[model samples]
Target: MHTTTKTSPIETKDLVQKTVFPILFSISFAHLLNDLIQAIIPSVYPILKENYHLSFSEIGLITFAFQLTASLFQPFVGYYTDKYPQPFSQIYGMLFSLAGIIALSFADNFYMILISVMLIGTGSSIFHPESARVSYLASGGKRGLAQSIFQVGGNFGTALGPLLVALIVVPNSQKYILWFIIAAIIGLGIISKIAFWYRDHLVLRTNQKKEIVAYHDLSKGKVNWAIAILLIVIFSKFFYSACLSTYYTFYVIDKFHLTIKQAQFHMFIYLIAYAAGTILGGPLGDKIGRKYVIWFSVFGATPFALLLPYVSLFWTDVLMVVIGIIISSAFPAILVYAQELLPKKLGMVSGLFYGFAFGMGALGSAFLGKLADVTSIQYVYQVCSFLPIIGAICYFLPNLKKK
Candidate 1:
């Protein structure tokens, strides 16, 4: 009887270390809905450009406005939430997105579109940091796998957006964006459930007075330098990604002489490959090392990206898929690596990385848009093809894995 009693605590501890897949998958589903609604913004950009008769520069500004709001407030939100966690905060984000969708569906002018996208971006800022925290909390020591599942949801959401837009909104008018509100409504319910679980989990954690600490041998200076290197890698990856996500549809249309719907379908294929890569990156990082995955994911795509500009139409599609998979794999590994670097500061670290990523994407979209206007979409690809070379710096990042 004494032995049974003594083993109970050890058993409980073991259970705590086991991955909580139900929570992980539930939160992932919520992430899917949240990002699906957010994806509506960029998915409809071509439509917005045509309807408003806007210039490429104006389209860039719209991306700038959306991503600026999305990027600027995330770190603060994460910082605040780190000190004072909010279980239901994602629900608030959903409401903002709902409002944004309604506003966007009716928007007849460029300024209105900007306002709508900003609102949606604000919701994104709130959703990501907190949701990432939730993933961390529920990870049960499988941090890489947890982050991958969380990220894959968002990637799938992002991929689905263009396909849905091509089917629903592309054939019709902009007012069809209202259909996205259904997703927002569904997200609210899922998030609320997750919030209840998070609240209970927090209470349990507080009661137990248990904390998780990840110790590494690296110095603070080395950690900071490593972080900077990761950010630079993020800048390279997303800057190049922005060229495709924001302008690839147009690029394909111009280069292949395809219709907008056909172009979106091509973009959908790339995004689907991106989602598939995201699925691979996280678990592979757990098995191998994040540094290795980061090194390969970014630099490995360089050859494909450099060749994409000169490829035939069929080859361009194939190259885009290859580049998407290779490059997209880096983010989950990079993010999980950062989280491991600053394990205690989960919210702040998550926010900072996500915020910086969005900032880079915004800058890339705006810069590439203007560049596309100045030269041509094909030229933008030629310039961006070199960005992935920046991944070679991954050599400097210290491996967090123990021997």
Candidate 2:
């Protein structure tokens, strides 16, 4: 819903045009809670595979189902919220996540688990676009830093998932997943507060804060072409990520004969570095401009990624961290760039990019899993190592810097 205040741009600048740190941190913490719950699904894949006597292809399907559901709905959600602006949508999203996690805890068969994850994915679809819009609304002129604060929470939560699953779910039992209900309860409360903030802020803020005039100078065909190029960059980034996040644990376990728990620790280390990289990405984008960060973040990781497949275990751990940090920086920069590219369509842009990123990741995980079944997980890593080279297309993007 578009709320037109009588407040002029100059007046709005004085009254509400400053970054609201309280709102930013609160919503970001809620994002952390939401992703923490979502990450648990992949984090426990080993347990699911072992308990169900499933094949690698089944693991891929599970990811496909979850990510597909998550990705397909986001643009719709974002587009709707852009017009309708449902402040309490976050609460509803968390409630769905709660239900899905609870169902997942007791799921007995493959189909049931898939259905449960779909519900969880639905929750994510709703949560991300809405939270991202709120982050945009709260940005005040520091969109990059605000997005960084919001995104780092999610990466941190993602890093914690496998670590927590290893400590609690693996040693105890599958039912331990129910304990995350506590996280959901806390999330509900947090989102409720955020919803209140969103409701209050909606009327005060302008509909589209940042103007994307650069793309306007180009023809519509050129704008779409640039967007397609960015999507390719996203595909490269998330697909490579799918190879690592979903398969790295299995890879280390098979190669080094390390226990699953040990492998998860290495994944956690990679994810922690990933979180650190995300924090730096947005602020750097603000200071240096998104093009440089976007280009460097993805391709910059190439050397480490190439080295990873041939490395020893200790070196593997070190390389994974380096790769994680560099690759993880791409998203925040990529996202804010897309939002700027289509400033009037902020929700649509956010949803489309976020949705496509998840969808590509799903395809990557499923396709790589099938490839692993045909060849080997080690070979999958070797193949995916070349994805970052796709970042070279970043050279084709026009400079978006203002004169």
Candidate 3:
């Protein structure tokens, strides 16, 4: 009995470490590469606008196509993979992005640019749902921290995108985006290896309910209602994010008369703060409870965001960093809370939230773009400043974490 007990504990420990970190970090690195490629789109928008003689509405349409493609396919992909897991599918998704990047490099007109981004968007749709499920499977009950680790990678890549644009893509022609093809290739290789790990550890999938199942007794109606509220929080978060990602550079340029590179750098400041927040939100949720993190991340940003449209150039930069950090923290908490709400449907829940976030971002960018055209980019910021007020929805979310 003594020998058996000792062996079992040792075996379990070995299994836990092997299934969790190695796979999580590998998948996280893949996310980094994937998002870097995605970030390139917004980073190069100034050039796209100039090359295409695009209207603000047209620039918004580019995001519309990309986000629609990214959003619509995610839930379907998540649902299918939940039934029949596809470990290598991510590599294929990356290849599609590679094709899109190549086409985008030479895209002479608006339609071609749309096609290129749609393909990249398809890659994101395929990548996120599956990767998120894998993260959950490998989490070993540290869902929040694992998710944050996974997110930080993508956030890091996102932070890099604008910096790359400022240093490389801004001075060069459209063809410079082709440099990211190398990142896609590296991602494909990493995800291929991750497929092997996922296949090897498919046995671990059975334990997914261990953490959340105790609290899962809530009615399906409650789950749906909670999900609806969570969706609103996501809408507020990503829509505000879209205003920054899609239009902040233009806003800076118009208001401060900054050069394109200078505006891109300011955008990078916002994104890096966002990346930092992404890294912290997950782990903080794990420790202090997802609910508190949700409330803090969402409502906490309100004052900062509200101040942004009214601040001076120096304060604008400072307030955006505060807004980015506070606001972006909400996502990790929100996603983990939703996952626990419907523990059985991790893939579906993740896909829906991720998809909804993408959809909101697209819709906001397009809607705000038209608004900017009608009013002004500065007015759009002022309008979006109030989005965090919707975080009151968090007050309604049930705390799934048992005391």
Candidate 4:
């Protein structure tokens, strides 16, 4: 006698043609948890500095260690995964992060801290490319909105990190960082479920007819040129962003003499605006063309970013919101544009952009830390303010919407 087997309801539909909200949100929430855990490293910087009596240079080195490990491994991971997709791989990433978190909580020396963050960074390197591929697969052709949903969760998590650090780890002992392991546990459970869905989805796809592939009309050389320009734009955006994200609290503390908690609140406000901007970026890109959003998101922030350093505390806070909104929108649009440019290489494209962004932010943090050591925090802002001006080059990119 033959046995009958049951299939999931999702398998009945052409998943490529239908937006999978459940999976999109599941992966997005997983992204949120993943980034939240990662954000702990930056959020606890003040604490780390105070505890260890670390210089700005040392602080920057810590960030460098973490981001270097995170950035360097991603492209290789994406390339390998493209050939052999691993549905449960994110679980291993989470385990690495968990180990890092435990190590960080108990870390005694500077080198130990470096090693711990490097482990966490490794997990991040593993997480982003795969999660991004899952987002693309679940997009149902609404790539922008899907990526936005996936991205916004991470932005929101990043916003929460500083606030949580202020409330939890800052006022208390460094050992309190162990509290974050709960986030890891929850993330592991979520990614495990996502892995099952991912496995089933792969099986379904193998059994189904081939899906239509998308193409861009630009020549390979033009495509390569466009990619190079996008990387330049990424450098412009993320490097400046690193200055704010890594040092804004110190800037405010030095400039305005605010306490750590107060400065953290301010950081939370700016990051909240950053997260809100991510929501509008993707859907707007779908409607008005990603090139326009990319151009506007990057260059449009120039005036505001330029004015930020010279303003009063009140105006500085206001400009943070404005700059956050405008600048944060560029990434979603940029990633989706690159993915469309090389539709067949989603994993590679995502890994490259994400890795490059992390690398730029790391270099910015490290270099600016040394700069701040030599000059001042305010000087770092003045130098970084010019970065967004590079966005003017976006005018040269071909309009994908025209085809």
Candidate 5:
């Protein structure tokens, strides 16, 4: 008699609807669009190079333009988004990104492409801070899960970008630029509507109403260890980004002698693994501890990265996928760790983590590219393997106790 009634299982679908799904969906969609814009360029780089007779260094420079702009502006964007209540900043950022894509459609020379890439970077830069701030605020107790969802969106975008370009542009390469413009216009419409609706319904506290914390307050001695850890994370990210930017494309082409389309498909495997890792990593980090999760992830990636150059095409692809997953898993943990490191100054800490780390990584692309120029691309891959080892060492550094 006391056994009585059973409560209906909390409908997973219903819970998702009520909780974090919308935020995840919105951020994911935005990330997907942003990544798609960048993804197209790399996928079709071969075409661009052939058409324009561009050098490897020139191609590297073009890619740098996109990342440099995004990296440099990250702190400024993160600061203001945290301070400002208006959603229009994010919306306008999307609009500017679309404009950059549209401009790319008409680009006939390196300068024009550079301008377009810069515009796209400017637009893309705004999303991370604003979307991250929104996701964090919306997350309530489940910040790790929420961040994972946001990150998955980005991973999906990264995965899909090259695939999309391969499918659309590989056959009729001349039409690729036009397709980018069309996609931009469509994405802009969708983002504009959603942003306006979000602004209308959501009421936010003003900057005056919010308590302010200075950077110096958060950057004291206790947090220096955390900063050092984050620097290691940055180094790892640099290697990761460098590989994603250059080696992923080149490796497949060089090792297998595959066509652009074939190479892109293989790249998809790496991205798919990466996306899965990013999605799963955050929740796992919460379950265990962020520090432990990061340490394991960094350590796990090292073997796969080191072995990547020695394997055949099929096995190398498999190792790359595994490497992607391992690396991706560490990022959310790193982000959360940085946030915890400076609880009072979330915005500033986030700004430094997102801006400086990524910007420095973007700068690393040039360094890696030069290394590729001097030695071989395989050496670049081998050099990248050391980053995680360094990260692992930093993570285990006994003096750096978590505050």
Candidate 6:
């Protein structure tokens, strides 16, 4: 007679430190690289507009192409990463990103520019699934803090990318594209070494068969109420993030009547505060639980966002820093929450929360821009304030518990 035995899930403390740490580091660094591309363009849009004589709609289309690719490709990548070895996917993605950056340097027409952006978007899409899956599997049960650290790296990149562009690319935009190519070459060398090391250490047992799962297997009725709640939270956060990413710099310059340098100073302060918030939010979520951290952030952020449109120039800068901290804090908590709700589907969950929410936010950007055109830009802030208020209300919904 044969008996089947069920294996228990691994304990959090029993996780391998070597595998966990490196996976986290790699994902975080990859995030930084991906975001560096995103950050540079917005800061230098004025330069691009002047050089190309582009319309606002044309610029919006460029952003739309970049975001739409990342958004739509996420599920496909998530499905494949689950069933395949992921190290090569990440390396290849970075290579594609590098190619895109190089292409951007020599892009003469709008079509070439859109092609470059699409390549970058394709590269970025690959990273979300591959890195996120590895990080979740490696982290065992201490997933929240682990995910947080990974996210903070991207936030740090988002903060630093603009500053780096300001210092380097702004002076000579064409020359900086070469810098991306050089960086790509260096990245290829590093990735090759890492891949070789990973392969050397890999142990495949003759007796053990690899398990392959389909996307439908992962998605069937595994939906938790917590996930639905978390999606709403993500939707709300994306609205604010879209405003900040696409229009905040422009808004600050126009609304407050400040020079470029003055607006940039405010942008830097807000970015720093945002980065700090992400860093702190993760550990706090792990300590206090995702529910509390998320709610607190939304509640805290709403008033500050409301105050943003009404304050004086100096006070608005201070208000933005405060609002940045509050909104940024909620993101890591949301990421962790979604991952927890879908442990077996980390890549899809992360992709849904991060990629979909971001895409939706990018879509929202066009709507907000139109709102800014018809109504006052201050009304955009009014719309921003409502998102968190709705998020906070949803956060308290009874269905949020695991069901």
lDDT of each: 0.89, 0.88, 0.87, 0.91, 0.69, 0.67
lDDT of 1 by residue, 1-403 (tens): 3553333544545545668888899888888888888788888988888888989998889999988988999999999999999999998988998999999999999889999999999999999999998887788877889999999999999999999999999999999999988899889988988999889777656644366567787899999999999999999998988898999999999988999899889989999999999999999999899999999999999999999999898999899889988988899999999988988888899999999999999999999989989999999999999999999999998999755
**Of candidates 3 and 1, the better by TM-score:** 1
Lowest summed lDDT across 10 adjacent residues in model 1 is found at 1-10
Once model 4 is optimally superposed onto the true structure by TM-score, how far is the C-alpha of residue 363 displaced, in angstroms?
0.8
Model 1: how far residue 185 lies from native, Å = 0.7
Q: Model 3, range 155-252, lDDT digits (tens) per residue?
A: 88888888987898889888988888899999988998989877866644343333324356789898889888888888888998899899989999
For model 6, the stretches where C-alpha displacement exceeds 4 angstroms are 1-19, 186-222, 375-379, 397-403
Q: How many pairs of residues collide in each model? A: 0, 1, 0, 0, 0, 0
Per-residue lDDT tens digits of candidate 5, residues 312-396? 9879878877888888887777776676666554555566677765576566766776776778777777777666776665455
TM-score of each prediction = 0.96, 0.94, 0.94, 0.97, 0.86, 0.84
Residue pairs with clashing backbones, model 6: none
Off by over 4 Å in 1: 1-15
Record all residue pairs in model 1 with backbone atoms less than 3 Å apart, i.e. clashing: none
Prediction 6 global C-alpha lDDT:
0.67
Off by over 4 Å in 3: 1-19, 204-215
- Over 4 Å off in model 4, which ranges? 1-13
Worst 10 residues of 4 by lDDT: 7-16
lDDT of 6 at 199: 41
Q: Which candidate is the best by TM-score?
A: 4
10 residues in a row with least lDDT, candidate 5: 205-214
RMSD of each: 3.2, 3.3, 3.6, 1.9, 7.0, 6.0
- Tens-place lDDT digits, model 2, residues 174-247: 99999899889999999998888888776555543743233446677877877998999999999999999989
Residue 288, model 2: Cα distance from true site in angstroms: 1.2
Off by over 4 Å in 2: 1-12, 206-216
Residue pairs with backbone atoms closer than 3 Å in model 3 (clashes): none
Q: Give the RMSD in angstroms, all C-alphas superposed, for model 2.
A: 3.3
